[model samples]
Target: MRPAPLNPLTRAASLRALARTSPATPLDVLVVGGGVTGAGIALDAASRGLSVGIVEAADWATGTSSRSSKLIHGGLRYLEMLDFPLVAEALKERDLLLTRIAPHLVKPVSFILPFENPLADRVYVGSGVTLYDVMSARVGQKRAVPTHRQLGAAQSQERFPGLAAPYGGIEYYDAQVDDARFTQALVRSAVGLGASAANYARVVDYLREDAPAADEAGAAGGGSDGARVTGARIRDEETGAEVSVHAHATILATGVWTGEQQAAADADTGLEVLASKGIHVTVPRDRIDAPARVGVITRTETSVLFIIPWGELWLIGTTDTPWREDVGLPLVTATDIDRVLEGANAVLERPLTREDVVGSFAGLRPLLQPVDGTGDSARVSREHAVLEVAPGLSAIAGGKFTTYRVMAADAVDFAVRSRFPRSRSRTEDLPLLGADGAQLSASRRSLVLANRDLRAHGWDEARLDRLLSRYGGRLADLFALIDAEPALACPLPGAEHCTAAEVVYAVRAEGALHLEDVLHRRLRLEFEVPDRGVAAAEVAARLVAPVLGWDEDRVAEEVARFTSVVDARLRAEAAETDAGAVEAVAAARPGGGQGRRVRRIARM
Candidate 1:
């Protein structure tokens, strides 16, 4: 049978049903965390015909999942550490995402790993890169990307004129994706497969019995070993309503938040997820005036830094520092920005300064601290671990974003084998929502045309490509709305690449609740453009006002809140010197607005 369509009406009805009807029987699985891993698990379990539901404390990918380096690579640096399995696993998934699963959303991008110390270092790093390419090809994965090649200093300089001279390099291939959109698409696929999911619903506590009740009658089944975690008590963060959801199995994919959830279970899961903050600074394409062809990978003492090309902007980042404060909101500090700029400038002919930074973001990588506690969190394993905290609660942590599918599969495998005992993993060969061949091709052409033709309206090809790449075949769904309402096609006043129609589509179709969702994830105006989408907030709010039933007052309030968020982010970025300082600034920001907004349309 054909799967049901996942549209606005379908999602609304599912939320209503889940809220209204208390399931008489416990669900097969309940996933906590609406990030990539949780969404992947939801899709995996639901596709297998299992009863599944996922609850998130915030909007999808509002956490680390959305704030990432956004690379879908095999972790080339891991090869140097002789972690073959990690590299192999990530490479397989990278191929899957780029070719079979989310072709429209994930595409190949090349990176130039510069070698400052020539001679021995050149041959040594070149050999490692060769292995990386060889292994990728050995898997019989479609060569969606070209192979790597060695470049002399002059040739490398020609490719990336920004590089300071005497830089021999190895050019290799990787993939880039819009992390938030990919996670959202995964949730949508799971919903299409009958999985119930809700963002802003936080699992506050686990329901456990103090003692097992002795059934004198001795029931046919287990006789309620205190019902073995009958369910979880969840608080709807948006509405402040508390409810219980019963499930035979619960999977915790909360990433950095895994520790708190584990503590709530009161079980010695022996798992600890440490937060490692990585900051990325975005600058305009013209700022560097260098060859914008491939990404640049520079070696650092602890981790490698990447100068990635993200559409019209270049994303230079990432400092691997321990985060000691709030894990939920990791902010990019001025110091973090300075560190990245300093690192990139070490290779660039013309060094970058604070003035070149248009925007900055920070995300926490959930690292699995070993029980031995011998090594720092940065050196901790990137491999994922699944532990049964309690009879019904399972927690997974310590993995890279590129391997979310594998982590999801492992979590689902554990849940299925524990609960059903007869089921086997099926997601290894499964495809996401837009992966079908015909739909994928049509989506690509439509995206190209939409971007090319829309130039008359101020959208350049690069902007259109970025949108198409992020949405994949789903671009048509957005354009359909624009076709119905011609005014929706107008570009957001300040955010020229975005249109009023996108905000409406984000709310009506993409499950966007707040202005932040529209600005940050749905449109990416927050990161791609300067002022962090502040100037375009009012126009976006107005565009979605009818759909959300917002009166003039509500629209103005929404706009004000968005502007405050941007202002706070700017202030925080300026005030802090490191990730920790950046987080402090974020802590002081008001409105407690971490995720999506509630949709409230005024009665016409």
Candidate 2:
């Protein structure tokens, strides 16, 4: 069942695979960045039979990939801009992910756009929603979801119940996803397809050498005859171990860190990426009385506001502002939070407050620098651009999460021109790790499985549903953990819905190397809980210590560090100004230092 479960992403496997790859026998492709685009590139190249390896400075989706509105739709705003090609391309990719690529992870979601001016707003917004549905349907064999429909004030009030707008609204369908997990799934799928991937392996420097005998005589080696990028020197963030990897081609999908990475390689990146910071806050679902399960979209002074629904919580507010501060910790200040609350409260029947917030996060979008440098961050083009930053090295930037696969394919197609000319794009029809054959809906098979599991262990329906959402059809993997250790089946402390087995599985199967990685990225308890996972930090650390080779002191250190990080975030969120928030967050940096230190050396 479930295709025997795809290959697990263990820590040992990552280190060993990196050890096995070297410059003498260079990999066909080396991807720098473990975000969605880089992971997708690795899968695309490896699926096409290329020997590929991907490395990240931190965990997968530790950057902007995880900090999105979590929508998989042709940006309706782009339609207003008259950018049809980008919209069409995104719609096609969205359909692909929903139908074939990751059916288990991507699902349709409905959204309502409240209108103050019934007639004028309906005509304006209705046309856009209709066009969005039309564009999405035209890209695939079947309509991905129900088309747009108009609703009267009574109906809108019935659906939302907490409507501040006097006029009725129009509802349309898009899609929502767990952005972090979706990114992790991409990496896991790539690894399953023979791609070597390692998180926390920071690529510090470039490895260059004279052209090989197979190359055109004077094609390489400095100046016009550029030196080829043989590989890169990488450092293990955990143990500080260093190694060099040889790759025929190196692809940089470093997102907002594109400049720093290209600068380390000592080459002109050709394109500049402006870091546009976006912030999101989470509140309990009960705070909003919308029983229709429909997301809310409203216009803000800057851009649009999306109030997406999470399991028991509602994900709200995303402010688009230019950020030039420390990229390591993008903290949300009081002003940012207030801006979000004000925007949402202006339209919601009941307003959310600071006391209602459970968690918040901020991330930078690697928007392409405007030629005139005059437009707002929201007006910046999201189209990806690829360029040869150096011989045998290519970098791609400025694409959205929904279009990562297409961006990856395009980047690989550019990288392999002179090197692996035989390699071709093959990920168009490829499904991710959990998306194999026929996938039973969560309600369909999970209900039966939950009934059996409940009879056997008296597990709650919430726990089973959480497992299905995280693991999809691979719920058997958790079952295997429970079989091995009955005690692990118990719910994790402070995070009752999560099991101790899941924490252990995060390390042994999901390559969770650090306590923070497990809590923040894998288990996601860090933000989901009001304490920011503090109550579960020690429990999680102790549970995962053996698998990660952490002793008592290390466990204590991890727990303390995670607690401090949470404290810092809370303090930053309380700050009145950006400067004060940045200062407070900087003090909370693990070890009072920068996020990850990447050292580039020529003679390493």
Candidate 3:
């Protein structure tokens, strides 16, 4: 089938169509949430020639999806717990992402696991990593990444001179990606395959009863059972307009928000999903004085710590704390940052402080609570579950980021079986939007070098190769637009690696609706920029103004909104407690109604 266009124009039209349907046509599948899993489901079901529509209350990846460690791996630590199946499944998917699915977005990275005792530690960790590599090979997955190797103390020190101890370490491989971009690309790819997807469209309640029927007396009363879900009553956050869209099947992929959606769709389903918070801090590459590496998993008392490399910075994180606080604004508290710094600094010669942290983000993991109430969020299996809560409503949750595709496939399979029994999923071999061979090679160095404008901008073979590797073949399409408008090739005001044209492209082609979306996810300026892209907000907003049809007032508003978010992040970082931090971040978000609701809902 010919790929559908996923540019901004199409997205606007889709949203309009969704808003116009009075009684809403019943769809084959209606996916709530536009994050990675939902996008994946849309792609899976649509590729099978099923009609699919996905609705997100906010922008794509505006939640836990955008905030991740950004690593695509086999969960090396899981091996220690003897969770072989999860590790093996994740490894297979990791390979698929790196080689076949999103080679442009996902690339191999290396990490060093330092040890104080050379002999025992090396033997234990090395065995696990070696087994990890063997499993990847055993799965018939192409080993795009190299195998793990034992490193002597001297060699380890040479690679990471800042190591406190020189006993030795083991180097293992994994992959890194732009998580939000990957999610967007997944949505785009699904759209290209005829899936209907929209953002900022919130599902307030399930349409349980049929519309008033025209019987013998043409009476205005429901015809079907009142309890059975018929569709969803959706609200466009931007316009505050309500509309209903019927569907033959509904799949809830809202991650941490799954339980709430399920209960709204049906009260007696009684699904329990716990939100486990994980925080990541980004420091300048120069701060750590470590080689570009990945998989630096340090064993902790409760969980593992990872000091992974992300683009121009090192992403050190993640505290697996059970947070019962606000889920929507999962702000990284000072305490959380302190914990991460303490864990990561254990082996570092120079410890990282709040001053060294350029950017920090926290994501909530949707863990399924066990019935026995014996397991903690960390121990809850990353294995996903698909539960048919009602006749038309189904909820899927509790999967790791690496295995989103598997989770999506399973969820869609349940939807098909319970709601649309005739449909079959065909996404196993379906390539995403930019997966065509021609598009895959479009951003190659040779092709980029052929462009005179790129050459003029000092894009040598090496630089073009870097761009191609980062953008895959999609870089060609971006460059073509820049060729037509030379001014777009100029680098961002504050960020050197990113160009103004990229910002415009993000708004025009990538569905970037706000400055935060452009800086934080679209180009990663927030992570790469020292000020977290605070200084570049105005410039980025101006670049996207035309595409977004923003007037001067709207442009100023966007800029102000971006600044407020950055300010909130900074304030949250400075807060001493998690509650204060959550309040700070919540106060700065746009649309007071949604932000307050999110904060309240998250706390619940």
Model 1 segments more than 4 A misplaced: 1-12, 19-24, 139-141, 165-167, 209-227, 290-293, 371-382, 436-455, 459-463, 577-604
Clashes of 2: 1
Q: Give the CA lDDT, 0 to 100, for residue 543 in model 3.
A: 82
Give lDDT tens digits, candidate 1, residues 541-592. 8877877778999898888877766776676687655554545554545644
**Model 1 deviation from the true structure expressed as Cα RMSD, one decimal place:** 5.2
Among these predicted structures, which one has the highest TM-score?
2
lDDT of all the models against the reference? Answer: 0.74, 0.77, 0.73
Please report the TM-score between candidate 3 and the true structure.
0.89
Worst 10 residues of 2 by lDDT: 595-604
lDDT, residue 165, model 2? 59
What TM-score fits each model? 0.89, 0.91, 0.89
CA shift of 400, model 3, Å: 0.9
> What order do candidates take by lDDT, descending?
2, 1, 3
In the range 361-412, model 3's lDDT, one tens digit per residue, is 7788877765332211122245777665655566777787788888888887
- Cα RMSD of predicted structure 3: 5.3
Question: Which residue segments of model 2 deviate by more than 4 Å?
Answer: 1-10, 22-24, 138-140, 211-225, 370-382, 436-458, 588-604
